[model samples]
Target: MSAELDLSPEVPEPTLLESLLYNGFFLGAIVQLLCILAVIKPTSNWYEQV
Candidate 1:
């Protein structure tokens, strides 16, 4: 029974570097999305003005 339990694989936890990279990527995506919206907003306003 102990041998069978030992045979089970343990789940790996995320390291500090991995967590930082993951959060960085998430924030980068949000900033990029906001930038895209900003660019589109000006264009939309310009179109309305015409």
Candidate 2:
């Protein structure tokens, strides 16, 4: 009888470039939400001309 085990595997760690790309997408989403809110409401409306 013969048995063998494979202890090593070919896998790559995340590089800096890959990490930055991931964060960019996340940050963009938050910024977009803020922009939408700004368009829908105003902080003050004291200049209503009748």
TM-score of candidate 2 on Cα atoms, chains taken together:
0.59
The residue-level lDDT of candidate 1 at 11 comes to: 80
Taking all chains together, each candidate's TM-score versus the true structure is: 0.64, 0.59
Candidate with top lDDT is 1
The total of clashing pairs for model 2 equals 0
* Residue pairs in candidate 2 whose N, alpha carbon or C atoms collide under 3 angstroms: none
Candidate 1 lDDT by residue in tens digits, 1-50:
45544667788999999999999999999999999998877654567687
What lDDT does candidate 1 reach at residue 24?
A: 100
User: Number of the top candidate by TM-score?
Assistant: 1
For residues 1-50, could you state the per-residue lDDT of candidate 2 as single tens digits? 27887779968988999999899889999999899988988657767743
Clashes per candidate (backbone, < 3 Å): 0, 0
